[model samples]
Target chain A: MGEQLRKTPYHDLHVRNGGKMVPFAGWSMPVQFRNGILHEHRKVRGSAGVFDVSHMGRIYFRGPGAVAFVNYLITNNLERIGRGRLLYGALCNHDGGIIDDVTVYHLGDEILMVVNAANADAVWKWASELKPGDVEMVDATSDLAQIALQGPQAESCLAAPFDAAVKDVGYYGYAHVSWEGAQILISRNGYTGEDGFEIYVPTQLAVPLWETLFRWGSAAQLEPVGLGARDSLRMEVNYALYGNELNTDVSPLEAGLRWVVKLKKGDFVGREALLAQKKAGLRRTLVGFEVAGKRLPRHGHPIRSGAEEIGVVTSGGYCPSLDRGMGMGFVPPELAEIGTPLAIDARGALLEAKVVERPFYRKGSVKR
Target chain B: MEFPERLRYTKEHEWVRVEGDEVVFGITDFAQDQLGDIVYIELPEPGASLQRMDAFGSVEAVKTVTDLYAPVSCEVVAVNEALTDDPARVNNSPYGDGWMVRAKLGDAAQLDELLSAEAYQKLVAELGG
Candidate 1:
C-alpha cells in the first residue's frame, strides 16, 4: 500500500458498499458512495441516512477535577449541563482563535469530548499538556466507533433494534441502551440538522450495529451516506465546519459563533481576546451567499463589492436541497447584511452572488 | 460507457468526436466516475476561441471543482443547454446526452496527437481510476 492510512472499524463494509475512499485527515474515509452526493444528501433530508463518524476523537475526561478542568477549557457552560446532556462549543487558544469545535457529552461521573477527526491529535496534545490537577483524559478513539442515524425517521428506525428506553432521550440528550446485548451510548442529536441519534459503541460492535441499522432502516429508506453528502448537508444548514469555517486564525465570534462564547463564565482560554474583539466590534464577519446561477463560488475565492476585495470564501458548492450554488465567506460587517449584492471570484470569472439568510435549506427535520 | 474507436481522447480524460467539420467533446466515463456527481458545469459561450489545452470551463462535483480543458484549439459552436438545469446527466450519460461543448476545429491536425481508444484505456489503467 502507498503509505498506509488509518482505517476505521467499518472500512471493509464501506468498500464493499461501494464507498469512494478518499484520504481525509490521514484516514482512508469514504467521501461518497456510488449513488453520489446529491442522492445521499437528498436521502438524509427526505428520510434517514447513516454515517460512520468513528474517526472523531472520543477522549474521556474523568476524576474530581473533570468538571472544573473541562469548564476552564471549553467555551460553553459545562457546569450546569448535568448528565446525559450534550454541549456544542469550541476550544479556543488564549488568543481566542478556535482550536477545534467539539461536542461535550456529559455523563455525570465522566465527560466525553467528541472532537473533529483531523484536529483530534493536536487537541489531545493541547489538552493533555495543559491538564490541570486531578482531571485525566484518555483517547477512546481506537476502542470506540460512532455511528449517526440522521433524518426525520431516525427515532422510528432506531426504536426497533435499540432498547425502548432510548425513546426517552430528548434532543441533545443521551441514554445508555442495550444494543445487541451491549450497553451503547445513544444520543438523540446529530450534525445533519435532523432529529436523529448518534450511537457510540465499542469498536467490535460497530460492524454489527451498522449491519443491523441497514437491515432495520431499509423500511425507512435509510442509506449509508458518505462525507460528500455530510459536507453538503451541513453546509445547507450552515453548520460551521472546522477547517473551512472555523480555524486557528479565526475567532468563534468572527465565525458567527459568538453565542457559544461565555465571557461571563469566568476566566477560560481566549476570554481576554474575545472581550477585546467584542468591544472593538468584529471587522470581518462570516456571511452566507447564494450564487445567481450554477457557477460555484469556491473556497479561497475573493468576495467582492464593486472591484474592492472585502473578504474570502471559506466553503462553497452546489446545495442539492436548495437546487442552487451557495457558499459561506467572511466580509466586512457593512457588506454582510442579508440581500446585499456581492460578487465572488469563481475561478477567474466574477460570478453574480448576493448575501442571503443563513441555512440555504430550511425545510429540515431538525427540530421535529 | 463505450468509447467509440472512431473518436479521440485526451490525457486529462476528455473525449472528442468529429462531426463533419465541427467536433463534439465531453468528459469520459472515467472522468465522471472520478468526479462522483457533477452538480454544476460552467462552459464558455458560443463563438469563443480557445488555444489548445487552454482551460475552457469548469465542472463542479459535490466534492471538488475541476477545469475542463480544450483538447485542441477550436471556436465554441454550441453548449448543452439541458446540462444547465440538470448537470447529473454528465454522470448518468457521460458519452451521449452529457456532451458538453461543440466547436469548429481550429486546427484539425491536432487530432493526430490525440490518443486512440486503446491507448486511452491503457492510460486510464496506468492511472488506476
Candidate 2:
C-alpha cells in the first residue's frame, strides 16, 4: 500500500470531491465518489457525469505506413473507418489470444491508439518492435488528459463552454476543434452506452477544463463519477474489458468479438491462428446471464450445470438499471445458447441463472 | 467513525454488545465505511453454532466481499431480516439498526479475547491510519 502509485493531473481534484481512491493498474484512482456507485451510475443514465480517463495509454502513430501498421497489428478493419472515426478492436498475440482491447482514433494525419492502462507499456513496446521503418510511434500519455462526459443531457450541459456544435457529431465520430482558445479533440463515442463525448486536452489545462465543465453543467446535475460506475455501465452494455473479458488467455473469437476480426482484409498478427481456430470450431464461448436472485455472481465464481463446474464468470455484479443481478461467463458452445439455464456457485450459495442476449441493458440512449 | 465505548471489539472490525446472556454482534462503523455501500449480506441461519473466531457470514460491497468472523463461541439466536431487503442500512446505521445477529454466548469469558473500546481505537489508528 505504501508503493508510490502514479497520480493523474485530476487526482487531487477527485480527492477534493470526496473520491475514494484505490489502486487501479499502476495509478491511484477514484473507485467511487460521495454519492456511491449506484447513484453515480444512474445519474449518468439520466443527466450527465464526467470521468477521468487519463490513465489509459495514448499512443500516436504517424508517417507513411501508420494505417497499414495499425491494420496489421490489430483486428479491426481500418480501411472501412475513414478519417475522424473511432474504431474499437483488440491487439492479439501470435497464438490468436487477445493482448489488449484498444480504441483507435483516425486523425487523418496521425492515428491515435488508446489502450488499457495496465497493458500500455507492454503494447507500446510490442508495437514499437514490429513497426516498419516508414512509421513512427510516439507515446503521448503524459502530455494529454482524457475526460469522458457522458449521459443523455451530457452534451447540452457543456454545449456553451466547450462549443455547442458537437451535437452534430455522429456516433464514433470525432472533431478537432478550438476549446478555450486551445485545440483539442472531442469524440462522440462514450463507454456508458449513452450519448456523450470523450474529450482530449493538454495535461496543464485539465483542471481548468474540469472546473469549467462542472460549473457550466451544475444546472444539469453533472456529477463527477468514478471508475466504479464506469465499469458497471460498460459491463451492462456487454463491452469487453481488457483484463476481464479480453486477456492473453482468451481469443477474440471465444470472447464473442469475431465481427471485428477482418480475415478477408489481408494478413495481420494472429491471423493464421484465428483462421485455424475458425476451422476447428469453438469449444467455449462468452455468454451473458441474468441471475434469479440477489446473490450476485462475481469474477472467478464457478458456473455450474448441476454439480459440474462448466465455466467461470469473467464479470458479474448487480445491474442497478435492471434491478437484478447480471453476469458474463464462458461456457461450452452447447450451453452458450440463449435461454439455457445455469447455476452460479457464488462463494458457496447456488443461484439460478439463464443465458441472455447481448447488451443486457437495452434502454441505453446511445442512439439518442 | 465513532466506536461505542460499551461494546467489545474484534481486530477484524466486529463489535459485540453483551446483553443479558445474549451477545449481539455487527460490523463496526469503520468496517462498513471501508466496505462502501453494502449490496448483499449472507448470514448464518439462526440456531447455527459458531466457534470463537469462526466465519459465520459475509458482506458484499460493490467491488469486494468481506467474511464476518465470530468474536466468541455462540449459538445464533436471531438474524436481521431488515438487511435482506435493505443492505445499505449497514452503511447508514452500522452499529444500531445494522446489527446482524443475536447469539447466546457459549462462554461469557471468551469476551476477554476481544479488544476493549480503547484498545480497538488504538488498533484502528495503527492499522487503518
Highest DockQ model number: 1
Q: Judged by lDDT against the true structure, how good is candidate 2?
A: 0.90
TM-score, chain B, predicted structure 1 = 0.96
All models, DockQ values?
Answer: 0.81, 0.62
Worst 10 residues of 2 chain A by lDDT: A158-167
Cα-lDDT of candidate 1: 0.89
Q: Per-candidate TM-score, first chain only?
A: 0.98, 0.98
Question: Which lDDT tens digits does candidate 2 get at residues B1-129?
Answer: 788999999999999999999999999988987888788998999999999989898897876788999989999999999999999998999889999999999998888889998999899888663
Sum up the clashes in candidate 2: 0
Candidate 2 lDDT score at position A268 = 93
Instruction: Score every model by TM-score.
Output: 0.96, 0.96
lDDT of 1 by residue, B1-129 (tens): 466788799999999999988999999999999888888788999999989999999898877889999999999999998998888899999888999999999898998999999999889888875
